[model samples]
Target chain A: MASPIQENLVSKNAEYASKFTKGDLALPPAKHYLVLTCMDARIDPAAAFGIDLGDAHVIRNAGGSARDALRSIIISQQLLGTKEIILIKHTGCGMLTFSNEDAHGLVKKNLGPSAAAEIATLDFLPIKNLDDAVKGDVEYLKRSAAVPEDVIISGWVYEVETGKVRRIV
Target chain B: MASPIQENLVSKNAEYASKFTKGDLALPPAKHYLVLTCMDARIDPAAAFGIDLGDAHVIRNAGGSARDALRSIIISQQLLGTKEIILIKHTGCGMLTFSNEDAHGLVKKNLGPSAAAEIATLDFLPIKNLDDAVKGDVEYLKRSAAVPEDVIISGWVYEVETGKVRRIV
Candidate 1:
């Protein structure tokens, strides 16, 4: 049986597909850039970031961890032609609330020891100071040999409390 | 000096944060579920799928690949408390337009031989057939022992053409 959410997705998508006309946008984003943001439900990247239909790639992950998102970032830049990156981590981020140990312990608590064992090497990428974290991610990208030095990289803190984004680096 | 995009982000975010007041919502998503979708600018996951603030975590990647999103999904389910997964891959996704070879070649062309060597092992997670890809991701999640057996996993196609989402599994 399809869940209510799934059913709603179908109907809502039907309504949306009916009027959609931009079926010809190129595979690579036209703007030649990408934004890495948290998957926070409160922030709408398209509306908030002024990204158009074929503007830029938006990569979201928990805490918007640049390290965790590096795989996708490489694909976006190296394979897809994006030349710039805007990494955004937000305030009140769940990542700000836990440490690696807390996350590992929680995994054991919620999914049992085997689950914990499975993710024994996992880096939860928790945040201590949001500003430092954002700056650090930009530095990580800059220092990364895989990421070309020519690629423009900057980091920001998107405040969930007020919806304001402040550039950190 | 901040770039124009960075300045715009700050300004636009200020406009949004001024009216934003959903700061008191619970930390753990209310419905204990998460939606994985593409970060296509055209699709608004919150408005399109009826996902209210704090309802569910939204994990997005290039193709909404379950394999790529597994880390966040684990965190959402095991650490946060989400018990269900709604994985939605969209029509006309960039993932559908390339193969691993093409991706590797693009990387070599765009970022040079060193970059190509860096990502020689990357999967790129391209999609040959969208339907099969969606179904395969659901199966991947179901078979993963790290993901609890009881977790509700389903896949769907979010048609960017008309904005309709149809369940595949």
Candidate 2:
């Protein structure tokens, strides 16, 4: 038996799925480059970078941390056939707002104490420095056995107010 | 010394970063949610799902396949403290166009035979069925030891033509 919320979601999904024919939405070859960045409201990859719809693969996350977007990067490059990767971390990012302690407290309050404690132990959370964070992420990518050595990997910081991207390392 | 291409990118990124104040960005909590979906021009998660800035993290990939977005997911949830996850695979996805053999051949011709072979072995590429793909991604989220059991995992297929999201079990 499904909850009321789940039931409602199912009905809505079915209705949405009915509107499209299989032929209309065909996938394209995995050519071009891949970009990993933040999902902040102010940053627009298309306008800022002049990226068209079919040109590159974009993966956005909080803080634009490369570590956070690594899994997607592997799949995009190893599986999807992309050769170039651009990682864009941004200024005024929501990620730089909280500390590990604050996050642990929030998680404990919203989830549970145990869950919060578990999160604090992970090496990937609560980035202390922005420049170091970007450098660390680039290093991680470079060291990853899955990522090809020839794949061009670059890092940048996007300024939300100016709509520009600045390469950091 | 940076190359001409690297120098150009750095300038663009710095231009954007200059617009933000030190206080504009908020740091994330210990636990956050990272969402991976398609960049279908039609799906507006902000309007439809009511996701606001500084809310759940969003990572947009080509087809929302776990395999393609796996590295991102791992970093977001594991390092960023995201506990809940939503994987949105949409209807009329471009991923449905090429078969495994075709994708391999294209990569071989454009990139190299070894690169193509690498692509063929990845679990996330060349989705066979949309429904199955959604189910498989959810299952991967649930079964992965890296992901917590309590993580509220859901999968949906968004219809590009109708702008509706269909929940897939």
The residue-by-residue lDDT of candidate 1 on B3-108, one tens digit each, is: 7766666776667677778766766888788999886655677766767777888888888999888888887877688888999998887788778888778778
Model 2 residue A149 CA deviation in Å: 1.9
Which residue ranges in model 1 land beyond 4 Å of their true spot?
A: A18-21
Candidate 1 lands at a TM-score of 0.91
lDDT of 2 at A59: 71
Question: What interface RMSD does each of the candidate structures achieve?
Answer: 2.4, 7.2
Best by lDDT: 1
Sorted into a CAPRI-style docking class, model 1 comes out as medium
Evaluating just chain A, the predictions reach TM-scores of: 0.96, 0.75
Q: What is the lDDT of residue B62 in candidate 2?
A: 53
lDDT of 2 by residue, B1-169 (tens): 6644455456654554455443343445222565668744334454344344455566786567665454445555544566667678877665676565664555566556665555566433556689999999899867655556876788877665565676786
Worst 10 residues of 1 chain A by lDDT: A8-17
